[model samples]
Target: MTETVKEYLRIDGTEDDKLLGFLIDSAKEYLTGAGVKGTDSKRYELAVIMLVTHWYENREAVGKVLGKVQLGLQSIILQLKAEGLKSE
Candidate 1:
């Protein structure tokens, strides 16, 4: 597992290592649960990590990021569908 999200969150110390790891794992779990598979998994994982980390740092900007993240997710979904992954 990479620490890109932790670095993005500016958590260079070990004090919040567990929390940061949990957040990354949770992001991966949530994306997997959403049916994000194959090559798209890595792309969505990074997006989710950035989205979650950004949201955690700036809750007030949730509304703004939400649209962008949703658009990204939609693009991922479209790609998946085009690659023959069923919606249901």
Candidate 2:
């Protein structure tokens, strides 16, 4: 998962491995709290990547990129929830 995220972010170094790991964990936790499961789905992986990218790039309180990523994240979460409901 870290490798996937690094590829998505085009990052190539171990300097951020620790931070990326935390971001990945945080993303998973965030999704869990929002009632999102189905970790096997690509949507879940995408959500994590998107979240990590957003949080990483915007760590300095920059709002410029927040709206776009937030909307996409919300969409992914909604889709994941809808999919979960279908299976239940």
Candidate 3:
């Protein structure tokens, strides 16, 4: 997944790559910890929803970061799907 993410970021040439990496790391850490207790699921969901809403509403720096990350993720998924199909 990290390799896929890096590949995606490499295409963008955006300076926010480091910040995006940090956010992805933090989200993974939080999700791991949350999964241990079996609580915090709603909190995590709410946090994501709020963050997305804030990005859409602002349409500024944060929104740009979000857009790039989304595009990267989409590319990664598409690549993975293609690879899976090739294997089959």
C-alpha TM-scores of all predictions: 0.59, 0.89, 0.31
TM-score for candidate 1, residues paired by index: 0.59
- In the range 6-38, model 2's lDDT, one tens digit per residue, is 998899989999999998888888889889984
Q: Give the candidate order by descending lDDT.
A: 2, 1, 3
Ten residues in sequence with the least summed lDDT for candidate 2: 57-66
- What is the Cα-based lDDT of residue 47 in candidate 2? 90
RMSD of each: 4.2, 2.4, 12.1
Q: What are the Cα lDDT values of the candidates? A: 0.62, 0.85, 0.44
- Candidate 1: pairs in clash: none
What order do candidates take by TM-score, descending? 2, 1, 3
Q: Candidate 3: where are CA atoms >4 Å away?
A: 1-11, 36-88
TM-score of 3: 0.31
- Residue range with the least summed lDDT across 10 consecutive positions in model 1: 79-88
